[model samples]
Every structure is written in structure tokens, then in C-alpha cells.
Target: MNAGYVRLSRDDDKRNYTSIENQKLIITQFAAENNLIIDRWYEDDGISGYKFDRPGFHQLMADLDKDIDQVLVKDFSRLGRHNARVLLLLDEFQERGKRLIVIDDHYDSMQTEDDTIGIKTWYNEKYVKDTSQKIKRAIGARQKAGTLMIRPPFGYTRSHKDKSEIEIVPEEANYIKTIYSLYLQGSGYRMIAGYLTGNQIPTPSMARHAQDFAKGVISKHKIAIQWSDSMVRDILGNDFYTGTLRLQKRARSTVHGKDKRVPKSKQYVFENHHPAIVDKASFDLVQELKKKRIKSNYRSSHAQPAQPELSSPFGSCLFCKDCGSRLTPIRRPASGRERKYYICTTYNTKGRLHCSKAHLIEEETLMNDLIAYMKLCRNSLCKDITAYNLECTGDEKKTSVRKQTELQSRIDVLKKQMQILFTQKIRDLANAHGCEKVINESYDAMQKEILTQICESEKQLKTLRNSILTDTDKKERSQSALQITDRIIEMKTLDRRDIEILVKKITVDKDGLPEIELRYGLSHLIPCSPSCHLNRQENEIIYQCMNLILQSDRDYTSARYLSRALTDIHYPKSAKGVLPYIGLMLKAGILSQGSSPQKPYIINKNRFEIKKVMDTFIKNCCLV
Candidate 1:
């Protein structure tokens, strides 16, 4: 049996002679002239010759060892532009007792010895490489001029007046806005996707198909109304909806004919290139929220909430104090009832040898503890609003006006240098007799250095500007903290948003005690007034002893254990030396004496007076 192969690429489509139909016609005429019958045809349309993974070519190879004894093509280039692969194919045919024929190159394996096949293949590959370079240069030129034509994003359509411009499709734009709104309102990607699909809204591809159908263009493809999380995420991440044109994100690889992603720094961006569907501020905020969600491991971005009411407010904020791993929530059947508990993820996955214990605590217990802590903080803030204001005011530093002016001047100078370099490049290009390449290369290197310096200067300037907060900023922050704490105290139950706004982390110890770290340094505010007359050194010793006892796995710790722990941490206290502090704590009702003398120290942290003394000592030591 004989096999005929034909291929046409986008570059070849411009030439009438290289068209698929024309190539097939040429092969048929040659076969007829030679009295050879062609039994099967393999066609690869609009695929690059540099690629070897064409479906039609794959099918042809599968039959080559079975029914086909000969292969025919219009030319060797039709087989492939990859020189090594084309030459190997020719050799394989010769060794397999099969005949091969090329009509345009006038080559026949059975009748002629063509030693120039390698040279011909090499020339074909070189032609492809040169054509690829020319296309890239043309595209780059257009991109630099901001006139490169690209497909409009999901919420837009090509303008009739200007092919390079895009106009927002109102219906699709509304859907885009809805997606952003839902995401900002604490909806994950999958939830948003389900909502859209449930509402019978068309997907991006389906919308395009409907538009074509309205114009009387018939298609046999089925348009499904299903939306996927990935589709929704893509829409949310696309900056084009913010009136920005971000192009050159992907470039074709010349060797493999595959698209490779270009780095963001290398991609071209033109702001305000079109009307926006979503405002820039909202879009930027969504991006920041997405990043925070990912870093926190809050939930699977693609997962829909199983039960909204059952969702834990501590989502990803809960952790094990010992292992520093997230506490995964689980529902278990206990005493014929369902109980929700959070356990150390490390202990559950890696076993007890890796983590000391499960660090398990009931969800209700965590909620109550967190609320109580917030209330304590609120009370402390209320007791001395002036003191709270003073503490928070020191948190922000006033930027040096002289340094900011220096950064601004440096940035301006660098930008001016870049402009001068660009002008010099243009002047050299226009006046150069034969040194244009050298001139442009030198100018580009200099421009890149200047741009990097400008970027650093601008970042420093932004930091300085942000650090120079006014008195009003401090007052607003203090007020915000008070309001959030008040809400926490009044709410019946906490939700995910509330947790995200108020808490940074909640680390649980082996004894199921939670230590909450409030967001925005709210935890730094002392929760009780320090009326104790202890000196700084004495206060530090007390604080360390209390922390050691509370963090211990055992209920009771002796003075020897506390001394060793403190010494290992550079406190350098002997067992005899720590006994004095322990006695003082016991006298102050912070530590209780154990029943046995072997382990006589007990830290009853649940006692109200103990908590008060500890808080006072913590304030004196500045350990808050």
C-alpha cells in the first residue's frame, strides 16, 4: 500500500503553491504520471513543520509498519522542518524495505541515491528559523508602538471602528463585576463558579459561541452552561478588566513550536488601554486578598463550603504551639453526637513521635477563649484610651523629610537619564551608517541599569511616604481597634471575615490552652495595670518561670526543671536562685504548691488572681 502526506502551516498559507489542496493535487499528478496508486492520505493543517506531534502524522507512522510499504509527499519539507528527524525518517524507510518519494525535490528512494537530503533538510529548518525571527521582530515593533492586535479578554469584544481596540460587552461585563463582588464578599472561586452556573449564565466560550450563532454562523459544538473554578480564577486574575493591556505574556518557542510563558518583568503593559469593567483599586484588593488566603492556607481556593454554618471562624488561623503546624478541623462521633474538634495537622499526619501530642481542643472552647481574650483587650484599652493612643503612636515612625527628598531627586534624575539614553538611541539609529546594532545594544544596557535604579528609588520613596502617617491616622487606627474589639464582644458567634480582621494566629498548647495573637499589634497593649513593686530583673524572672510552667507538658514542674530551662535559654539561673522567684510567685497567689515535694510548683493559670499577677508581671517586663 502507498501513503500520501500533506501539511500546511500558517506561514505556508500565504503562498498559493504551498496550500494543502495544491500540494495534494501535485502529489496526485505525480503519482498518476508514475502509475503508482495512493491508498491513504494524512493531512496536518495549520500546524508548524518544526513540530513532530501532529495527529495526522502520528496516525501515518502507526500504519507504516503494517499496511503501508511506500510514502509520498510533495517535498521533504512536508514531512518536517526538523533536519535531524527528517533525515532519520528517510533512513528508517530505506532500512525497512519501504519506498519514499518527494515530488517537488525530485527525490526517490527506490530509484535514486540522494546524498543532498541532509543539506535540503538543513536549508528547510533554516528557512523556518529565519521566518520565526522575522515574525517576532514584526510583533515586537507593533507592541512597542502599542498597536499589536490581540484577542479581547472575556468581558470585551473587538471594536468595529478599530481592530486593535476593544469595547466592553455590557452583559459579560456585568457578570465580571458580579464575580469580583462575590469574591470580595468572602466567596471562594468554586462558590462563585457554582453561583454563575446555577444562574444559567453563559461561560466565556459559550458567550462567544452564542454571539457567532446570532450572526447566523452555525457550529456543531455543544455549548455547556457549566463554569469551572479555574475559569473563574482566570477571570479574576486578568488585569485587562482594569483597563490595562498586558501583552507578550507568552511567546512561541522556535525549537518546539510550543508556547512558553514570559516572565512578568519581560511582558509589556499599557495602562488605560481600554475602558474598565472593574476599578483598579478593587482589582488590586482582590489580588492582595487572594495572596493572603493562599499564604494562610485558609481553605482550598477551589473548594466550596460544605456547610456554611459549620465553617470554623479560626479556619487557618489556628496552629499548634509546639509544632507550629496548622490545626486541622475534624468532626467526630462522640457519645452518639457529632463533635467538632481541631487537632494538630503534624501529629495527625506524622504520628506522636514528630509532635508531642494532638493539641486537640473543641471548637466551642476555642471560640469562648478567643472572645474572652478580646474582651480583656477591650477592657484594657478602655481603661486608658490616652495610654493606648500613646503606645500605638510610637508604632509608626515619622519618615525623614530630607531622606524622602533625596529619594525623589534620585528617581527623577534616573528617569531623566533614561529619557536621554532613549533619545540618543533614536538619534544614533537615524544617523548611523553601519553601527546601528552596536549603538542600540549599548543604549539598551545603559537604559536597563538606569531603570533598575529608578525602581529601587521609587520603592524606597513609597515606603517613606507610607511611614509618615499623620496624627489622624493613629487616632483612626486606635478607634478601629476599639470598634472591632467591641464587635467581637457583642457578637453571638464569630465568622470567617471577623476572624480574618481581628486575629493573626491562635496557637494551642498540649493542655488545650489557646494563646491568641490579635491583628495590627492589638495584642501588644497591656491587658492589666502593673501595680507590683518588683524591679525589671525580678519581673523578667517571674515572667520566665510562669511561661516555663505553663508551657510544660506535665501539670507540675520543680525548681530544678525551671532552672535548667531558663539557663538553656540564656537566663543563667541556678535551681537555688529560681527558688526565690518561685516562692515570691507562690506568695502572690500566681503559683500554687503541689501536694508532693518532688514536684511542688503548680501554675494554676485558670485562677483569676493568678492571671492578674501574670498580666502585671508581663507588663513590667514588656512581654506583651
Candidate 2:
């Protein structure tokens, strides 16, 4: 039977023309025209098409019981717009003996007339990326022009004359102010969210009341409702609450037209955009307080409850005490129950496999170490700050003057280059002749390099601003010292949430002794890997994944499964980010996957050689 799939990216509000009903209609017409029977229609409404984790899409793929002959979509983009994901899905379909037909794009399942699917796909991918860049530029341009790109937030309303200008919404503004005040006084996020919901205060989205808002031609009325935890968190996280207009907190995907939250480094933060809802001092304090809160409950040592980590937790941490090879996690089936243990990654390999086997650390130990480390880090900031201030930073003025001048100089140069590049890009477009591909590539490469340089310079400037002029001793002595107080309170309890915020890295020495690194509210001290501190059980699992990849089939699904399982063990690190390394592993025959036109995957192997290599790398015996 033929199936249809429809996906509306997160940023692309589907309540408009891209609604399920409308998509069904479009696909139904196309299917009828082609005399194809519609077996099932899969819809991932309001989900980003950048990743293949959408609920409906996964279900469609996993529906092995049902006989699916072909899959149809409005465009290949509906399956996924990301180049990696799109190609994999297409390949997967072919593997499964199921064909895919994208109607709107004229990509037929049976047709190989042009035989340029790969090139066309690349073009489509580039188009998506180019479109995203254009959108960002547009937003940046408006922001530079002093025009507001977002709504006036919950408490404020847009001025009648100027859409960019913000005016307080009188009653709502007062309520919002009260909320801020209450939060500063120690009201938690959930409590505040509950309070607003209980009082029936309209959420920011609800207050918009756009009865005929245009998402596209076909529109629908979506009733906005009360505030939720997520909404409250978003509001609280906004630097604009402190009278700063920080634009570009989120970015649109080039391929999917979906929104993903950008790292703080990429944001275009302009101070004093609008009237402050809360003072800068108070806003900063709130941010600090939020950091002290930690979530402790975890099913595995590698799991992080709420936030993404900057570095891998498990990288360069696990090692075998006996052989000095990294201990890899091993799974054993005993009495119908699965138990995890650690073995030398090279234990069962050729050439004197070393180390007497050791028993696995229980899951409980994993939880204990993670929670304890988290608590220690969250609680140490104030003390560390105190210690750091006393020991270092005798020459503040010298650093400040030097940094400020350098930043200003760099900014001036970048602005001049940016202007030239803008003009050059226009010229390139207008004069598209003589190896257009080569010309475009050259221009794009230059643009990318320029943007990267500008971004780095901007980051250095931000760092300088945060430090330099501020007197650590005087600041600490004068106002209710935010650092010392937070540290004392958080460390005492060692709460799970507190630990999550404070602990940066946990490294395990050769003797199974774990070392925890604290962030100390400073960027410089952050460790690259924390999971190194995890016991042997965790490392074993990572080793297993490496072995599975080396021995099994090479495919996205296989790698994803390995990633998921390893995550459950203690490699809470993401495999997706290390795609190049993974690809390398596949090429080296250290990792392998089963061949399937659709859903290629890595299989579990009962060997320790793969784990040994990974262990050596983690222990720094082998460089990454």
C-alpha cells in the first residue's frame, strides 16, 4: 500500500495552510491523479524536519507489520530537509523494497531519467541553507535599524504608531512586574507557572488574539491558553527582562525552515532595547539563582535531565587500572536479566590482552557519583570565586585597557570587510557566468571564513566586557555577595539540580578515583569531559557501541541506536555531533553496520577489541 507523509517544521506554524487536513487534500489529489491507493498518511505537525525523531515519522518507519509498497510526500523536504537525514531516509526506503515519490518536486519513485538525484538533492540542501542565512541577515538588518523583530513580551504591548516600540499593557504589565518581584524573592519556576495558570492570566501567545492571523492562505483559529513551565522558563531566560534586546537567541534551520535555539555565542545582544521589566542587577541575580537548581533523578549515569552540555561527559575518563587500557562497559545476560560490567576494551583481543576481569559497578553507584559531583560543583562557586579573587587578578587595569582597545580595533576592521563582502555577494549574483559553481563556492567560502572570524572577535569582546572593570573584592564586600551565598546554600544540600549546574567535568584516574571539576561561574575553568569520572560499567557500554559499529552494518539508524544505548549506560555524549569521527570509524572497519536500503543499523557484538581502542583514546594514550 502507498503511504503519504507530511511534516510542518516547528517555526512553520501548521495551523495555517499547512494543516493536516490541507496536506491530506493535496496528497489525496496527487494520489488520485496517479491512480495510487493511499494506505496511510503520516503527519509530524509542528515538528522540525531537520531530524528523523518525529513521532509520526518513526511510527511509519517502524510499521513493519503492515505491508507498505510506496511512500509519497508533497516534497522530499516533508521527509526531512537536512541533507544527511534526507539521503539516509531515501536510501532506507530503497533498502526496504519500498519506493518513495515526492509529488510537488516531480521526484518519482520509478523514474531515473535524469540520474541527477544526488546533485539535485545537494542543490535543494544548499537552497535551504541559503534561505536560512538570508532570513538571519534580514532579522539582523531590522535589528540594526532599531526595529523589534519579536513581540513586546507578556507585560508590554506594541505602540500603535511604531510596531517596533514597546508600551506597557497597563494591567498585564503590573501583573508581570509582580511576577518578577515574586520570582526574585525566591519563587520557583513551577510555582510561578502554576500561579499564572491558577489565576487564569492569559499567556503571551493567548494575549495576541490573532483571529485572522496569516500563517499562509488557509488559516485556523488556535486558542492560546494559560502559562506553562516551559513558557515561564522561556520568559525568565530572556535577557530582555533586564532591559537588554538580545536578538537571535534562536536560529532557523537552512534545510527545514525550523527553529533551533542558538548558543549564547551566536546571539546579537544589544543592551537597553526597551524599558527594563527588572533591573540588570536583579535579572543577573535571578539567572544565578536558576543555576543553583539541579535535577537529580536519572535512569543512567550518562543522562542529563534538562540542558545540553558543551562537552562530552564520558570522553577521556574511563581506564583500566591493571592494563592502563580504558575499561569498556560490557553487557551480560544472566538469568533472563541484563547486567552491565566493565572489561578492558582490548581484553579479548590479540597480543597479550591484559587485566584480570573485574565486577561491574552497579547502576546506583553511577547515580551517586553524578549527583554528588553536581552538588559539589554548584556549591563550590562562591568559595572558588573567593579563592580565585585573592590569589589571581592583581593587574585588572592593564588587561582591561589592552582588551578594550583590541576589541574596538577588530570591530572596526570587521565592519569594513562586512560591507565589502555584502557588495561582492551582490556582484557575484548579478554576474553569474564562467563556471558559476566554482565562483559561487569561492564567494561562499570567503563569506563563511569572514563570518567565523567576526563571531570569534565578538566573543572576545563579550568576555572582556563581563570582566575587566569589575572589582572582585569591592563587589563581593559591598552588595549581598551573590557568589558566596549561592555556594554555601547549594553545597550544603548537594541537591541534584544544584549539581547539574555546578559540575563541569568528572574525570576518573587509573585507580577508579573520580575527580570533579567545578565551573565556578567562570568560563575558563570548564572541563571538556566529565564522564571520565564514571566507574567501569559506563565505559564498557561505550566500548560495546564501538565494537557493534565495527562489526555491524554502517547506517544512521545503527549509529543512533548505539548512541541511545550508550547514552543509557554513561556516554551521555551525543554521537551526532561527532559524525566525522563516526564516519572515520566506519571506514576503518572498527565500526560496521548491516546494509539495508532503509533503516541501516549497528548490531551488538560480543567482543572487547573495539572497546579497547576507544578506551585508549579516552585515556589520552591515543589522540582524538
Candidate 3:
């Protein structure tokens, strides 16, 4: 029995001589010429010959166990590309007393000792290797030419006319802009994802599938639009929207290994390769905000303790100036009033040895100071916003104005339709109970979608207007921001969300007075009051203890230790007598008690400085 085997590789060759039909014809002609009868034919199409995992090859091997006398092929290349696999198959056929013939190569495996056939097989393998190398070279050339190698990002698609370039999809681009606005406005990743999903916005995969189907790249299939937190995160993280394409991002390490992402340094990027959906400024801002979110991710996992103040309005935005770590909120009610104070995380958790100070600040005092500061700078902040707007105004004012009008018009129309739908639902309220679930879901989705559209249009308008703000426009924006701040300050109950939307961070100074930095306004440094006053003898003794405390180099010295050190330094004062000095200093405000387990008295640096300067002044006066 004789069988014919043929293969056609996608990239290797699809030309006339290498086509499946051509190979079949060549094999038939050779079989007829050689007077060999062919029984069955097997073929693998559009598959690589470098591997024997092809379907046709497997069928041929299954039939090899049969009483097959001969296997006919167009050439040694069609049998399989790998030299070793081809040689092994030839030897196996020889063992089975079956002749494997390559008609085009004029080779026969029956003569296993023939070295010429071996050379022909080697050349056939080289043809495949050469073809593969050429394909890789072609790709490298395209990459060098700044070709768009990836599927277009979420806000874009490949141009209908030019497959190599991306064209912005207006509707989809709006969704992308809304995502940025939502994040910048203080929405979390999961929040953004839920918002998109709730709005019934088509997921990236679903949108891509539809686009591909329309382009005839894919056949008709049910597209399940599912939005996930990961998908939302990817869109937020992608730099492609900034008009850059980074290609060859990931590759498998080896045949059996997992896919490994290539670092940015190793990636080939085409910057400004396409029209940006999100501007570089906005993109950069979002990236920085995302980085802060990542650093504070651990803070979110912390469950609120039993006290109300554990849930501070500052959240992770409160930082200890001394340790550069987040300040931990401690609930310590003084007298009967509930109070919360923020302290250095290092000092609170790892002890004062790790951090010299807690940078403690009363939450109410911090907020009051912040409010006072905002009121002080409100007018200047308004002017600054106006100046920013004016300087950042885009030159394409006419074009942007037209686009804004168009978008606003669409938004108005959608709103009207939604209002009509809502009215209809209200009118049909009696009959709506049975389908309430469906109706509510549809209504909510529609409402969110419309709101998303309005937000997107406004964002685009802002972008177009503020791309390059003029001096006059800056004044207008500053005035607008000032008005918003006025409203925020007037609110009776301010929460973390409210604060997060306006302030970038709250930096606590070493003295526990917070420096509240508005996102776009000036940073306000709250003045700290002196905690204590000292008398003559108290100043002299506390000054000595302060020196000892400074020289100790420990985080802080206990009042008991300071007393013993004072006794040694004062000569006349015994350790027993020094306890009264300690009591006097603690009462007179020279020392501050910490929340340490033993409630040890720590040196009050502010008061110590006050006494140090006085001591110097008195000594200089005496000398004079």
C-alpha cells in the first residue's frame, strides 16, 4: 500500500509550487511515473512543519503501523522540516521494510546507506530555518519603521484604510476620558470598574470583538460584555492612550515556561505615534496618583478600630514629617470629650527608638487650622486658578468650542429621552412591579451611561479649553475653584472622601502641627503653640537635663533617668533630691509625657529650645 503526505505552512510558503494542491499533484505525477499505486492521502494545511504535532503527520504515523509498503511525498520538506524527526521516520520505515520516497528530491529511504539523500534532507531543513529567519527579519524591519504592532488600545482602533495606524473611536474615547476623570476625582479602581459595568459600557474585550467582527477579522459570535476590576485597572495603567505604542512587551522564556513581561528598557516604543485620547499631562497625573494609591494600598486593608477617630478624615494622606511614614490615629479621650490624635507610625508601632517623634496632632485642631488656612488663601487661590486656565488655553479654541457644542447637544438629547423614559415608568407604576427588576436595571444602566457621557463631554471641553490656558481664562478658572473651595469649607460634616478630592496630602510637622496641602492651592503651615512655661530654677535644671537628653542619642530619656543624670551633673543634688526637680519640670512643662507603656516623660524640645536660648541670654548678660 502507498500513501501520500502533504503540508502547507502559513508563513513558510503558500505560493504555486508550495500550495497543498500543487504538492498533491506533484506526488500523484511522481507516483504515476514510478508506477506506484497510491491508496490514501493525508494533509496538514496552514500549519508549521518545524514541529511533528501536525494532524496530517500524526495520521500518517498511525497508518505506518499498517502494512504500508511505500509513502510518497512532493519532497523531503513536505515529510517534515526537523532533520532529526525526518531521519528518525526514514529509519523507522526502513526497519518496517517500507520505502519512503521524496519525488521532487529524487530521494528514497530504502537506501539508508546513501549519503546524498541525507544531504538533500539537511538542505530541506535549512530551507525552513531560512524562511523563519526571513520572517523575523521582516518583523524587525516593520518595528524599526515605527509600525503599530499591538491591537489598538481601548479608546482607538486600527484605521479602516491604514491597518498600521490607529484612529480614535469617539464613543469609546469618551469612556476612556470618563475613567480618568473618575480616578482623578478620587474613585478607587474597584469603584471605576463598577461604574463602567453599572453604566453598561462594553468591556474592552467585548468592544474589540465587535470591531473585529465588523472588520471581518472574526466570524459572528455572541459577545459577552463583562467588565472586571483588572480590565479597568489595565486601561487606567496603559500609556498607549498617551499616544505611545510599546511593542514586544512580553515573551515566553522557554517552551515549557510561563510568559514573562519585558521591562520598559528592553521594549521598543514609538512615542507620539498616534493621536492621544488622553493628553500626556493627564496621563502623567493619573500615573502619579496611581503610584500614591499603590503605596497606601496597605492602609486600606487596615480595619477601623473600635473608636470613631480610627476612621480619620486624613486616611493615608496624613504623614509623619520625622519618620516619612503614615501617622497612626490614636483615640485618647481627655476628661470626657472624645478626641483623636495622629502620631508617627514608627513611634506608635516600632517604639520611639525607630522614630524620634510621633508628630502628634489633634484631628479637630488640624481640620480647624486647615479651614482657617483655606479661608485665608481663598482669594489668591481663585486668581491662581484663573491664571492657570488662561495660560493653559488651547489655540484650537474654535474647533474645541464646536466639538463641545456637539457633545453637549447629544448629552441634552439623551437626558430628554431618559426623562421621557422615567415619566413613562412612573405612569406605568402599577404595571411595573412584575418587571421591576428588569426596569430598574435598565434604568440604572441608562442613567449611568448618560451621566458618564456628560462627564466625558465636560472633560473634553475642559481639555480643549485648558490645553493652553490664557491669562483671562486662568482668572475665570481660579474664580471657579475658589467658589468650589468656599462651598467645601461651608459643609458641616467633612469626611475623608471630601478631603481626598481636594487635598493631595496632610504633612504633620515635627511639632504635631499639620501642613495641609491643597491639590492645586498653596500648602498651609499651621502654627503650634508653646506647650509649657518655665521659672528660673526650672530653666537652669531643665537646660542641664536637655543637654543630657541630647547627648544620650536615644529616642528619648525617661524622667527617672534624666533625674539620675542631673544628680551626677549637679554634684550637690542627690538622686533622692533630684526626683523633686523631675516633678517640677514635668509640672512646669519642661518635659512631655508620651503614651509609652510606662508613660515616661520625654524632653519637650520646644520648651527646651525656649530655655536654651534664655540660658544663653542670661549667661551673656552676666558676662557683660
Instruction: Evaluate residue 311 in candidate 2 and report its C-alpha lDDT on the 0 to 100 scale.
Output: 18
Q: Candidate 1: TM-score?
A: 0.56
Model 1 regions lying over 4 Å from their true place: 1-3, 31-42, 55-71, 111-116, 144-150, 158-191, 215-222, 241-244, 272-314, 320-503, 508-624
Candidate scoring better on lDDT of 1 and 3: 1
lDDT of each: 0.75, 0.58, 0.67
**Could you arrange the candidates by lDDT from highest to lowest?**
1, 3, 2
- What TM-score would every model get versus the actual structure? 0.56, 0.38, 0.52
Off by over 4 Å in 2: 1-65, 68-94, 98-114, 144-146, 180-239, 252-266, 281-624
The candidate scoring highest on TM-score is 1
- Give per-residue CA lDDT, model 3, range 12-34, as digits (tens): 65453577887888888888887
The clash count for each model shown is 0, 38, 20
Output the number of the lDDT-best candidate. 1
Rank by TM-score (best first): 1, 3, 2
- Tens-place lDDT per residue, model 1, 422-459, is 88789889999999889988888677667655764565
Writing each residue's lDDT as its tens digit, candidate 2 over 283-366 gives 665576566433211112222222122111332233444555544555557558765434445454533435444322332344
